[model samples]
Target chain A: MKKILILVVVALLSATGYGYYLFQKPSKDIATTKPYLSTIAPQLIAKFGSGQTSSSSELLSKVIQVSGKVTDIEKGKESIIIVLNEGIKCEIILDKNPPFVKGDYLTVKGIFSGFDDMFNEISLTKCYIVL
Target chain B: MKNKLLIMLITITVFGAFAQNKKVTRTGSVQFLSKTPIENIAAQNNQVASILLVNEKQIAFNVLMKSFKFEKALMEEHFNEKYVHSNKFPAAKFKGSIPPSVALDKAHNYEGVEINGQMLFHGVKKPLIIIANIEVKEDLSISFSSSFNLKLEDYDIKVPSLVKDKISEQIKISVATNYK
Candidate 1:
């Protein structure tokens, strides 16, 4: 009887612990998570270049990895947005000391935010250089 | 005849520049706050793209649902999957124009100017008018800011009855962007 009671108590404690853990869980860490899809910069740009992409786009909200060449770099207030092949705007956490130029080939990963037709670029946030 | 043609060409070029004076920004910010007695929820997205047609006094904003970052992972996931359905509605957009008399650039500051436009969100289209504040800096950059209350039902965003009190039925949205 004592052993069974102890087992019940142990199960209760674990359940409570798990509940706490779930309650305190932080947001997704993009640096450590695996990307849902991978594509070339130009291909991705071509698919959404029309600027008419709606909810039907398959890559919305998915973390995607892209391989491309650097075409432009913009320094924003908080992040450095590196444009891949002048199409994909990959935002990095470190805004200072931008390490990219006009012709560097690179691989990057981030959440596929959306296509900004006004700016003619696809945006990625929380980007990390995969190297 | 050659001198007259040259004058006509110069006039056309000047008119073209005046009509197409546009300003665009990619690193715009939009933030929303939901408050209730039980809990106050907030999220912000900085990857907003906005364009200002200066001469026409027109503006538009485009924001991706996936870019909104919440404090808690589970709350954000639930917001995207259940509330807004980011998979089905990836973006929320607004396209509107201000009145010609507003004179968006002639003055250094203006407050409470109304802009009427159509807003598309959660696959629902609704007419929206924003009361905004505008500031023209010495460097000729313009700063626009606005805040408004958005009703959940207007966008067809339904919340479960159990979680109703935790989230406000009306969310306060704040938008700010700089065009240089």
Candidate 2:
């Protein structure tokens, strides 16, 4: 009976521990995660710019790797935004600041948020510089 | 010589009008707060974008639901997957115009500007009037800010009874954008 009680107590404690861990789980680190697909910045920008709103929803939340030349870099309070090819906006949320300067050819992996018609640019979040 | 001068004057006028009429930005900020005794949840998205048509006194904002990052992963997941169904709709947008009475050409601080427009969210389009404080600087860059409250039921966002009490029905939204 004592052994059974000890086993029950351990199981209950472990269940609570696992629940706590899940509740405190951090956002997905897409930098190390394998990308769904790869493409260049201009091509992605063109597709989304042509009023292909449906495709944006399809790619939403999926990690993608995009390569382009950095055109503008806007450093915000929380993260660094590297504009690619004068179009795509890759926001580095997890990694606060990246060392890449303007005109540097680079590759980033991040979750595709979607196209913003206001600016006509593709948006990425939780971006991590891969190359 | 007179004709050439007239042509030059026309060209200058067109170019100056084009340069001063529009301003846009991609790093606009939008924040939402849900306060209840059980929890006070707030999320801000700096990735949002806005456009200011100074000539027409028109303003519009676009923000992806997935862009709003919450402090807790579970909360973010629930917000995207269940609460908003963001994958289907992806974004909430507002396309509206400022009152015609305000002079947009001159640089001045305009307060309590009523923006009348339609807000499209959760695939539902509803008429929304946002009160904003707009500052038009000498350079023609605009600093626009507004805060408003929205009821979850107004947009057909139904929270299940299981967590209904925890989440407030009235969600406060704030927007700040600098158009350059």
Candidate 3:
């Protein structure tokens, strides 16, 4: 009877711990997660090139790390966006500003949401600068 | 001969500058508020891609469903996994043209503008017209803001019967962006 009671208490504690973890806030540091890393030039060429259909099965809804030159930096009221190679756009919403500037060579890590057909570019969200 | 070459170069440079006046922004924000007797839910997506064609007075915006962030993790997950089904229809887009009264080349600070466009969301396309306030700064950057009401039923977003009262049928949406 005592062994059974101890087992029940242990199960209860683990369940509570898992419930807390499931409801925890989304992580902001996606770079350290070792996402699918690639260069900005190839990513853009594959997506926006005239002959390409942007049908890459490898990139959809995956965490990606892209490195390129920072072409634009937009500091909006809600977030800071960094455009790499003039096309690969990433926005950091929740995290504080990283130490970077326009023209700096950097790598951004975020989830590759998808290609914006209208704008003809790859979009990444919840992004943070890795280097 | 030198004079002719210089004149030719000047004309080409001037034309090239005018043709490249388009401005774009990716940090645009779209926020929606749902108010019901039981709860008030709001989500904001800051990773909107948009462009303004200065020559044509046309504006286009594209945003991903997964980019919308909610106050609670559970709410965000339910929104993406259950209602919107981000895996199937990943993006929402708007393409519209502004009125002629809002001069693209004018250096005015702010002007009231009308935009008529088709909004594509959840694999459904609907015609939408919006009244917006536009700001054209001296630096050639453009900013605009607009608010509209969206019906969840129109997009086939189903709210479960169990918590029907917790969600609003008509959601209020507000969008603001700055293009540079």
The DockQ value obtained for model 3 is 0.47
| lDDT of prediction 3 | 0.79
What digit string (tens of lDDT, one per residue) describes model 2 on residues A44-73? 877775544777677887898999999998
Q: Model 1, range A26-131, lDDT digits (tens) per residue?
A: 9878889899988898888888755656632677767889999998776556666788988888878784697767899989999887777667788888889998
By TM-score, is 1 or 3 better?
1
Q: Give the per-residue lDDT digits (tens) of candidate 1, residues B1-180.
A: 999999999999998676547887777789999999989999988778888998878899998888888898888888899999876777899999977876656647878989899999999999999899888777677888999989999999998999989999999999998887
True contacts kept of 3: 0.54
The lDDT of each candidate is 0.84, 0.85, 0.79
Candidate 1 stretches greater than 4 Å from native: A1-5, A47-58, A95-97, A117-120, B1-20
**Pick by DockQ: which candidate is best?**
2
Q: Worst ten-residue run, lDDT, model 1 chain A?
A: A48-57
Superior by TM-score: candidate 2 or candidate 3: 2
Give each model's clash number.
0, 0, 0
Off by over 4 Å in 3: A1-59, A93-98, A101-103, B1-21, B109-112
Total clashing pairs in model 3:
0
TM-score of each: 0.85, 0.86, 0.80
Which portions of model 2 show Cα errors greater than 4 Å?
Answer: A30-34, A46-58, A72-80, A93-102, B1-13
lDDT against true structure, model 2: 0.85
Clashing pairs in 3: none
Model 3 chain A, poorest ten-residue lDDT window? A48-57
Models sorted by DockQ, best on top: 2, 1, 3
